[model samples]
Target: MFVIDVIPFARFAPAGALSYRFNEYVLPGTIVSVPLRKKTVPGIVVACTSVRDAKESIKTAPFVLRSGAVTTTGILPKSYRIALTKTATYHLLPMGVILREMIPEAFLTHGFPKKLFAGTGHSLSFCEKTYTLRIEEYKKIISCTKGTVLIVVPTAVEIDRFADTFPSAIVVTGALTQKKRLASLKKIKDADIIITTPKYSFIPIPHLAHIIIERESANSYLTVARSPIDTRIAINALAHERSMQTTIGDYPLRMEIRPKPGSALKSISASPIKIFDVRKKITQAPFKALPEQILSIIKSTHEQHGRSAIFAVRRGYASTVICRDCGTSVRTTDGRPLSLITVAGKRVFRSSNGDTVIDAKALCDKCGSWNLIPIGVGVERIAEAVRNNFPNAPLVLFDTNTIRTPRDARSASTKFDIPGTIIVGTEALIPWLNPSNPISLAVVASADSLLALPFWRTRERLARLAFSLTERAEKVAVVTRRPDDAIFTTLENRLDNAFFKEEDSMRKQLNYPPYGHIVTIRIESSITKIEKDTALVQSMLKPKTGIEIPDRYATQNKVVRTIVYKYIDIQKWSDEAQELSQKIYRLPPNITVRIDPESLW
Candidate 1:
């Protein structure tokens, strides 16, 4: 029987190299059931090999393999596989976990893909908001008049709105359920018009057509977990394989050019990134800052035949619980707040099974008062605040707590049937860029909250957010105590094009990614002390490679630290990365290590 290398479908579990033998004839990229924990779970077949490193004493030695019947299930293109390996190695995550995101979950399984509009596609003769024909957009479809058209956008908001305009297209996104997702993917292969998120383009299409990125520079296009797989790289792959030229707005081009020359050179025309700075509007809002600026703006904007949105960072109602007598937030050791609930019109405990409510028997550590109040509003709290303030305006709440499904939410927003409503949400609000929705103004009440964080890439993100704000609305009011900070200075200067280069330089100098190589090793073996683990890592590396500690930690049995490798031996580095990752995999049960993490943001 042939042997197969399978990556079992488990995330964040104790990991080991998945080279063990399995059933027969399964091809690469095909999903199959493998033993995991108490039962069998499905996973993608990564490779086929006769190589076996396990001891002869093991019963499963020379494990048999099986070929998956899914259309001669295949490996990703060589380039994409290499990129995927680099990300998995760098992040120290299970290779399979990264692979799971490599292609979508659907095409690997039983169902067929679907097209966006298909038979009921809403044609776009004119812009929904402007009611004016965007003949500029139509030219591509009518002019090509041959190959199928694939229009990709950074967010579902754009996709939902844009897809309906086309008469027969399919919308593919993370929001679609597993069955529907596969249906959409299968059906869209031959579709004339296809709307999709960036990553899934790796799936083959029936024919090559013009590629369009609705708004290019969206942070959604960035690899939240890996750098090389960003939308820019995906487009390059398409161009290389299909000979189709990709189109992007001016925004994404600027970020990519500084990192690598000609990385973003698509012959292009773009609308200007318009800015409506409301720095002056906040001062004119009748107070140094309107305590309820978020709610008031929503009420006023909707009243004026325009829609408005409020953006906050988290879910749930109130963000913090504080003793009114003294300013101290109640929280847990894990950095999550100590949550509360009101049951049946009266106060109750957080969980029926755990912990005591209200420290009636205990004193407040800060003020000795039993009275506790919540501060720091979340998106839900802000929505309720809008309700309290507007009382009469039409309102729509969009957030994790309220919206059950992403597809439903995007579809709801796309309808444009409900006007004069406030869309209050978390990071969900980042994509609502309707150019002619009569959304004349926007208010970022806590825009600086994300900027003020201490993460490595805060400055770059701040600039991106500011640029996006300007592009999203005609008038924007950014609320912050320090309106004159350096980030804002860079953000406010429309003519300042140096932000990318300067920020890129800093990321490089610090040995952060896109500048150099990085890996975070989390050690969990009880027998090994923190210092011993550190030394073990140091001895594993060569004297020539630059390795430095960004941070080190130890809490008895738990130890973790990040190592930066700025100058790599390019010829052998990739191989070394794989070897080291394998060694990490075989480490004792107590150790935990994740390489390049999802957010240093």
Candidate 2:
């Protein structure tokens, strides 16, 4: 008999590997089936020992390894394995949780490897080096990079575009089918250049010696949909472990640039962005959602036979529904306020949760009053207003509600291709517009709404959007009640560098990301136990840096929840973060945690 430690697929079962007994030895990284707790489970073999040592350490009954054809899966390289363990420790999660995110359950089945190619055996030297580059220099680096290169983009659209730019490169993305993915993997087996989105950047390519992060500043690179693993950190770890060169390119680069000649990146050309003060308009038309100036601009754009776009902050018909007399918002059975929408010509109220839909005639629960008012504006509202203003113009409502599928999105874009057409959409429209095809006029329906968001990156996100729109349109107009806001200065002066500097300084001073790290913990349970659970978790963490103790609030399912924020020094926290996370992960079943959450909402 032999002793070995195997990491099971259970995400929250425990924090360490399980002991297993096998008559024969398997490599440490091999995938094997083992009998676990009266059930067969797949696990990664982490260690192996002699039979004599196994007999000496026997305490509980050891389970036998299931008889099967064991395949040594390259789910991770040696360096990647170490990085994953470090990530698990840093996030205070079991190795299984992190592994679950890396390897999907479907890929775990069937013992055979699916056309995975072995990367080059070139051993990387250990060194810490960072390079800053201008746009032209960045392009030069991409053009001059020898050996197999991995270019990681933020979106699928960029994947297609980059593949065209580097025709010699093979493309891979999550959007590919299983057959296409396999084909893509085979194509890159020996290719000198590979282009991919963040989803497929981990596929092993033997000659992969360099990595280029295109538009690293975009939030799409951050995997916020599921596990909150930053691809940048994973790529950095891979580069360090394998001795590969790496470069990050963006308008306002995410990393600090070294003081070197020709290091400062050049700004791309953009149309002039004009800021319009809507304070007077708001005073003149208090009841109207959109100002007369905006309506007139839309009408004039239609009259001039010019294509235009109006960007709104929200998606539904109305942002919120409230009781008129009580001044209280109508909410779902849960605590969230309901948003007003129109379906089949009947008014309805939908909660942000997406499932709770109520009739508009429903009385307010708090006051039992029938009189209610819809407040705020959304994409649907803007489309309706545009249609009213220019009845003869070709209008396209391009928000998520109207455009449900890829086909629908494509059809909308095709319709948008018509000249003199008007497209009213949410932020989702930003990715669809190509700079090569300039729109005549681009209008931000409500800049104040975006600036008033609770997020710290509000201005940065708005600035990024504004720059992108201005670059793609003949003219970009921003309507805001507060024209003196810092964002307006950047827009009016066309100052990308000044905005980036001010934003970076604010982040450093406030101890936000890129300077400091934050982990958010959310606990949900019965109202009575929610407070107690929150206290228990707060007690577990050491307040070496910062802790936010927000009050527990009620949500759907009558569940009360509280969010705990833990801040740590970016330089010193890695060593201690694993220990802190381990303690928090051991909490009761009612609680869940997220490291570096993209959005608290």
Candidate 3:
């Protein structure tokens, strides 16, 4: 018999390794099943030793392996395993949770179809590359690199197109089925060139050399499902650990990542953004969702047999309905404002979660009065306005309500191929637009609406969106009440560098992320329990660390969210992160912790 230390791959468990007894020796990183609390659980072997000599060292080997069969033969290469640990600790998540993300379900359940070799040597060379000539850069990499090259994109929908662009590259993404994942895994084993999404980027390639992270600014890279992890940062860590060359490229490039000596930079000119100020007109005329100037642009485009798009921040018919007299929004039982929309020619009130539905004309839930009104226009409202204004034009809605799949989104964008078409959509439409079917005109329903969001990165997000829209279309117009806002002028002049500089300055002034780390501690339980837990967690903060409790609020679900910002020197970040994580872990299970959360709200 042999004693092995393994970490169980179970959710909601403490971050501790357990020892198990096995008849045969198992390799570190091997996936095996062991008994745990009257049930069998899968675990990764960290270390193993023969029982004859190790039994004295290990007394409480609580469980024994059922069989000597290794469920998964492929081991996480040592460097990748270290990267996973560092990421988990950095994100304040259980190591198993990060491993769960790195390894597919197929690998955990069944052994690899073929045994793989793990390379222990590193290249010992690191550098950064930036490129403005996207196609040319890809060609250069393809022609120069002899070893395996891994290319990671923002979404799985883009993988097919990228694979087509590089015909010799194999594709892998989270969207693949079980059979397809296995097939892709097999293909990746021998392929020197691969194109995949961030979901499958962790799989070890024996001859991996370079990693290219496209669209580095994409919000999709910052996954928030279980643990909020910046995939770009994780990929960069992996590349550094492997000593490989890395390139991160995006339009209106991210200013934070410093450019290395060997970098390809570009000078992009800005597009003039037209702003239509409507504050003076709203008081004189009835409230129109789209200003007359934007409407005229759309009409002119239609007259020219051109396509246009209207971008709205919200998705429903009416984002929320409110009481005019009481000033109270009509909320669901859970406290979320009810959205008003029409379905099958019948007006209805729907909850944000789509679980509750009521009559659109129902009295206010709070005041029981009939003086209710829609607060703002959503995609449906914009669609209605477009249809009424341009009666002869063909229009399609591409938001959460209409888009059920990526294919649907692609099909909607293809509709713009025909002239005189108007597409009403949310941010989902951004990725679907291309040069072949570009919109002749792009309209922002309200710049004020985007700027007023609770997120701290509102300015940065708005700047990026404005840049993207203006760059993608021949003309761009923003209908807003605040025409004098500097952001509008920045977009109008296409001064991306200036905008980012101001953004960085503001972030540094406020000590927000990329300047300092924000660790959020959250608790979800009965109201009383949450209150007590949050108070306890708050009391445990060290006063000397200069940790600022910026915001602490409770949600409708009785969950309390608390954010604490730490702006210490860069050299001490990792140490403090580990300390804070350990402190939070010591709290009751009712509480959870996240470092550098993707969303602060």
Top candidate (lDDT): 3
| Candidate 3 backbone clash number | 1
Q: What is the lDDT of residue 168 in candidate 3?
A: 85
- The residue ranges of model 1 lying beyond 4 angstroms of the native Cα positions read 7-95, 104-151, 154-157, 170-193, 206-305, 315-330, 333-377, 380-388, 407-419, 436-438, 498-505, 508-513, 522-601
- TM-score of candidate 2 to 2 decimals: 0.83
lDDT of 2 by residue, 283-355 (tens): 5434555678887877787788889999988888888888988999988766667898878878799987677
Local distance difference test, each candidate: 0.53, 0.68, 0.69
Q: What's model 2's lDDT at 532?
A: 78
Best by TM-score: 3
Ranking the candidates on TM-score from highest down gives 3, 2, 1
Task: Please list the residue runs of candidate 2 whose C-alpha ends up more than 4 Å from where it truly belongs after superposition.
Answer: 1-21, 24-75, 103-139, 224-227, 254-268, 281-286, 496-502, 543-557, 598-601
Residue-wise C-alpha lDDT for candidate 1, range 105-199, written one tens digit per residue: 45555422222111122122211111123335455554664566666677766776666666577787776787787777767656777778876
Pick the winner on lDDT between candidates 1 and 2.
2
Displacement of residue 524 (Cα, Å) in model 2 is 1.3
